[model samples]
Target: MAQYKTPGVYVVEKNAFPNSVVEVATAVPAFIGYTEFSDNKGTSLAQKAWRITSMAEFNAYYGGPPQSKFSINPLPAADPKAPPVTGDFSITDSATKQRTEYELKAEGTSYILYYSMLLFFMNGGGPCYIVSVGHYGDDLDADKISAGIDTLLKEQEPTMVLVPDAVRLSAQDCTTVQTNALMHCGFKMRNRIALLDVYDGYKDRQDPAGDCVGAFREAVGTNFLDFGTAYYPWVNTSIVKEKDIDFTVITNLDVLTDLLKKELSPITDAANPTPAAKVKIDQLNAALAAITSDWTKSQDPATDKQTLNKTLLAVSSLYPQIILAIQKKLNLLPPAAGMAGLYTMVDNTRGVWKAPANISMNGVVSPTVAISNDEQEDLNVTTQGKSINAIRSFIGEGVLVWGARTLDGNSLDWRYVSVRRTMIMIEESLKQACKAYVFEPNTANTWVTIKSMARNFLTSVWKRGGLAGASPDDAFSVFVGLGETMTADDILEGLLKVSILVAVSRPAEFIEITFQQQMQKS
Candidate 1:
């Protein structure tokens, strides 16, 4: 109503009905790890969140995966013909006039972020955030990793947290970081979930019932365990190729050159042979002696250093290659990143209630630990309530996420990952929609509108097979009022409480069939 005398016609169209809840993004995970490089345009992205949509986007912002290295001291009586550590490690064997000989060798460790990124995008992960705690050269300590997860505290869009590189830390440190991640996801945010990876020792497929499982349980502890889920054992992936790894070896070049000079010095031609043969030997010896540090240097002053650097495989480039090669030896890796991708895929294709299991994983050759039914029995249902899911490869079905339990394996209510995740989705969606009611009078009108809004949103979820009931009434209930969800004193203090209950669908983990003999109708 305006002053009638001077006012002209002013029509304002407003929302006629209650505002509905906008379902929160369920699969946008924030990955915390060490990156080869993290930059957008030119600014550094260290300890900050960067959104990436595809592998191309990841490459554009953060450089491709990094190389890991392994230094191996030759064993007793080194064999000159020993196979290279990786397919490309360099070997060196040399002998002096005194018959003294020695050797050297090297290997690669592929950057978890790079190959894991490839696997994630190939499977089904979409726009997600990445926190590059440090560059490849920086120390990948638990502190750096903890800081990375901490950066996500300011971000609200990411609903899941993953730290694929955490396995690289010490077992004790790994527990600390994982504990922090769980607290961040479960206690602090309450809207997000944490995905964990078992330690690398579990990658030894021979240790299905190894002490590492118990070690993991002891380290992670029981506090806020329900907020997280861990998948084991690790997985062997085809995402990383030898070329992708770019391994560099300190080959037998120097050794071969030394050996050649040693053998040439004792040639019969050199001892008492013809003058021409002796001259030829002398010339060859001179040539061998000329192979000095400057031999690889270019003649041009401008190109000398650059050429030598390239020819020598400068410390920066070759070190990564060395590392990448070592990592390639055991191609199996932690499962958190790949599982994050699968979660995104399942959430997008089906509702969140659909357990992300029994589906073939892309780019997965096989699981590091072959968890047979018998082996998984202990892992999936342990007395300690630290259930580890199995990523098993079937005879014909390929590799699948065979289990769906959360870390709180013994809790009847928060037992399944789907149930926990579905509730988180609902809670986040309603919380966001309630923002409109902030500062508004907390009265009966507000309660009714909130209830209606929630009902409409949940009814749609029910239709989508997220709820387990036969109808909307059976599937969920909403309570928000003075006497119901809030008391008079609660309303006076501006605390408008709204309670909601929903029957989340669980995965049919086991099916039973019963048969009885019947008399034949003759």
Candidate 2:
């Protein structure tokens, strides 16, 4: 109210509607891993939570993908009495009739944050946060990844945490990082969930050494199971293309050179060669020798790599095969990033209450390890109650996310991922909307206003099929009066309290059809 000493005609306006609750974002995920670089102009985003909306922004700040290094080595000769030795790839020289078995070993650079980002965006991911713990070639440390998870504590928009590079670490260390992430999401913040990738997820569940899922269950402790979800059998993807990699990825050029020389000897050692043929062969050999020499002499061989790579590709037919092998290795990535993107897609297209399963993943060829129906039964339900989601590929359908349970499979309340996420969304929205009424009067009027605001927000959610009920009253309840939620002493101590209950919708995970034989219908 304002007093007017010399006012001609005072005009006042009264607000008719109460303040509305704006829903907080529910799909933004925070990814923690290594990158090529983390810089914005002159600023460094290393170990910082940087928000990016598109792949372009990520590239501008974090730079492009890191260059991976691989080495092709000849397999050792096998003795006649001993078992035969095998290699990842094999090529036989027709000229010398020498069978050479070679294995491709990725050296130095194996960071996957770049490819994970590509997978996320390809699967409908939107705005996200990137926390670069270190650069490429740096050793993967559990402590560093834990520190990256800690940085998200100050941020409120990230509703999920994903450490895609954790799988590159040892199984024990990866478990340590995942445990920290779950603790941060469930116990500390209580606003997000952790998307975890099982270490050795590329291996089959029934591997001779041990079951990957069982090992994950034993190592990942039982704390905060509801706040985390794990996916098994990493998916094979086409995110890495032929142009993305070249001969430069090979660390040892000597093996490649020897193989190419032996392969080209037939043409060069001909009895009667034309002038043009001889000149072409001589020039090709000189170029190949020069490329190896320059790379060996210089500390950094990437200076003239593009030119040398072009020459190598034109000279040798083996170059494309090696590049393809590298591409295949890079394409086998963990499933956490793809799941995060699917969560975002589900939340955006259908409300957050919808389960993020039975949906095909973009840019995915198939799951590395195919899981049968019987195998998935053990994964979906266990005596220990550690549930792992599965990604399966069908003949007609490309690849789909199959299961939707959290790590705590037996909990009736928090078993489903959609239910847990919807609760978080509702809780966070109301918490933020109530901040405006913090210091207001603690009376019937204030109570009514707060209750109306919450009911309106929940009514909107219920209408969107987020809550399961016949009507608004049946869907949710909000109470804030003195007798209902607070006592006289609580009011006297300047404390205001409110209680809310919502019947969040649950997914029909299993549907059974009953059949009966009918007789004599005329």
Candidate 3:
């Protein structure tokens, strides 16, 4: 209302159209893992959520990939019949007085965040958030994972949740973390997807129907399978390189070998060395050369020391590449992070309803387990509805993501990942759009405006092939009014209710055709 005392004429503008509903993005994933560092321009971000838009940004903040992990703790039994470690060398164990046999394995903490992010962005992942629970060398147990998950609760932008290091936790602890993740995505956020990875043992198992999948199912429980998805047979990646492991951490093998030999028995102008002693000396010298080439100059001021370091002190470094190659081969990454990357790729190229399956995965060398169609039958269409998607490598197609069902495999409504994601997109969009009419008068005009807004949004989705219907009416229906969606008492109670029914499009999981001999008549 304007005051008449002003004695002036004024032209006032008013909004002519109702508020429009804008579809929310459904691809941003928040990965929880370990990186080389967690600092942003000298500011510590450990155990905190940080936004990274590009690889350079992530590198500048969190640093690059750390070295692969390896150790020789689990040694083999000593052979009494075999010749002793003679002539030049002696071995010592921390626990026992002396050690005889050593078995080197990549069993230390894996600094996978940098490489996982590399894979994610390489496979078409876009701007996303990272909840770095800790840096390399930090223990990532169930408590740390759960704490990492809690950081995402305040973030509304992330539509997908992934814990790439879930395999590192103990079985019971992993179950606790995953259960909490399901709760966050399903009951708490309701707008995000939980991409989980099976236990590491599933990657190399000879049997698919036995304890592997059974262990996973028992741990994940049955409550909110619809909110999350599990991927099977971890992916063997080439992302790790020998150069990534800082070689400098190893001691000079030749010098140590000579010192041990001299301590055993002084050789002053003694006879020629035995063949076994010569072999040991040669092995030591070669390992020392490798360390001198890579590790000795690693401390130079010009060298970038962001990469991590690993040591296999107990084993022979005669051919370090053999051990390093084994480490790379054993670097079986869980599928959650990769799936997040695929989710973003598919949602961008095709709409959310388009299943992210039968598509080749970038940055993957091969699937750890070769899954045939018969093996995938139980995985894709399981009776328990605990669908585990498979990653299989075909001859020409490369390693492709083959399945697209959600954890709720048997449900008609929320079976496929696309259907679940599509509904989330729509639901979030409509909920945000309705915020504009929160305290507006509850009248026919308001009801009509809200209904029109929702209908326009759904109609656009249908036009873009997100919904299934021959007409907009058949595609979706929006009801909001005095008699349609709410009663007189509901209005008095300050309740503005709207009932929306939509025909969500489902993926063609199975495409079959009927053929008959009569067709020859045509």
lDDT leader: 2
Model 1 clashing-pair count? 16
Candidate 2, 97-211: lDDT as tens digits: 7787788998875799999999999999999999999998788888999999999989999999999999988888898999999999999999999999989999987678788
Which runs of model 1 end up more than 4 angstroms from their true locations?
1-14, 70-110, 201-210, 245-330
Sort the predicted structures by TM-score, highest score first. Answer: 2, 3, 1
lDDT agreement with native, every candidate: 0.76, 0.90, 0.76
Q: Indicate whether candidate 2 or candidate 3 has the larger lDDT.
A: 2
lDDT of 1 by residue, 1-522 (tens): 555676587777877799978898899989988888888778999889999899888888888766444443434444569842333333332333223323233333334777777788878989899998888776668998898898998999998898888887777898889999999988888888899988764455454555676678888888887889998877878776543332123343354344445444445334578776566565545444444445544467345433433332331233334445544554667778888899999999997999999988998887766667888898899899889888889898999999999999999999899999999998889889999999989988888898999999999999999998989999999999988988889988989999888998889999999999999999
Model 3 misplacement above 4 A? 1-12, 72-103, 201-210, 245-324, 519-522
Cα RMSD of all models vs. native, in order, equals 7.1, 3.0, 6.9
Candidate with top TM-score is: 2
lDDT-sorted candidate list, best first: 2, 1, 3
